[model samples]
Target: MFRISSVCLCLFASLAIADESSKPGRLTVAQKNGWATYDTELKKKEDAVNKACGSAVKSSYDRSTYPAFDPMKDRTQSACQMAVGTLVEVCRTPDGKAAVKEAVTKTVCRLSTEGTKVSLDGSVLTIHIDPEKSSIVGKEPGSYSWKSALEEVL
Candidate 1:
């Protein structure tokens, strides 16, 4: 009975971890937007790869020396290119572009950065909220503002 209980507990623990891992990373509204951008880029690259290497290209290979060439290798490399390390979305600067520029220089990141657009840093891809451009206006009354959501996070 003891052995069976221990095994069941272990199995449940592993299952829980697997389930959590399968879920998308938790993010603020701005972060979700940034992640969507990255996702779009990934899809674009995947589409390009599929177009270029979805089918094996004809190669001149001697029957005796080399019977086959692997187009899968090229396809695999292109598919791998779709992966970007991590994405961070910085809080929007409501004060305007000048404030955003100043904040970018002062903001510190815990992680190392390959590219930074604004407050986001220490990741392969980073984006900061651009108040003027990165907004959605709705004709209907009482639309939620991304800036307000971002302010709470920041």
Candidate 2:
């Protein structure tokens, strides 16, 4: 599971402008070896994420090494355009494939996105400046939203 860090607003004018649309309540999904979730306020939802990041050891993990993507094999590249640019890694242990089919056929993946790119393969989502443009790559099949879970690197 990917650990979510606290929302630290950088003195970066570029980031402030880019993330303005996302607002104070941004949600980040971490699908690393474990499962972790974080809202804009940095409140963790995963038990493991919390335990690991607790007043115990490492507070967070280096996202670059984790949430790896394989663009060559993923197929969920269509349903991720809603959140482009943002690193939207998906969990590929649940009904990821089914979710993709549903999201595509039903067109129900219209969530929050402003400066992100959409991408989906089999697993993983490469979110960017826009959530609408999130990309996807293949992770382990059966992952939660595998089509858009952990494919591209932000």
Candidate 3:
């Protein structure tokens, strides 16, 4: 099933995400830094991610083990996700790398999917969403999200 495959991908990707934010400086690379991105396309891809999460959360109503929904615990990840490619490339923004590193150390937390009945644990933020399923899906045993290396190019 597409869901299962995606789940696996998310999990494997998690190993990468956990270590990425630690790069020398900012997670976002600037053109001057020789880090480039396909901004328009990245926007579209990020949009897709956003749309999938929003739609999935809207449709994800069936509950199994997590008990009745709590808005705080079960809010949709639509906001955290970007539409850029699920697979992202990373590099430090020349000037902000140090600041970004510090912020991530202080701010990062264990992640989980909000709407998916599948309790993914690889990331605090869900990586890929199935609109048809209206759920956040991922791989690995805990924390659901894409690798940090992937987050930079956008």
Cα lDDT of candidate 2 equals 0.29
Best by lDDT: 3
Error of 3 at 88 (Å): 7.3
Better of 1 and 3 by TM-score: 1
TM-score of each: 0.22, 0.18, 0.19
Clashing pairs in 1: 112-122, 113-122
Number of clashes found in candidate 1: 2
What do the candidate models score in CA lDDT, each in turn?
A: 0.32, 0.29, 0.33
TM-score of model number 1: 0.22
Deviation in angstroms for 148 in model 1? Answer: 46
Q: Report the candidate with higher lDDT, 1 versus 3.
A: 3
For residues 73-140, could you state the per-residue lDDT of candidate 1 as single tens digits?
21212222212111112212234323222322222111112321223233112223222233322233
lDDT of 3 by residue, 21-96 (tens): 4444433233222212222333454444334323111112122222332333433234223322332221134323
For every candidate, C-alpha RMSD to the true structure in Å: 19.0, 19.0, 21.3
Q: How far does residue 104 in candidate 2 sit from its true spot (Å)?
A: 31
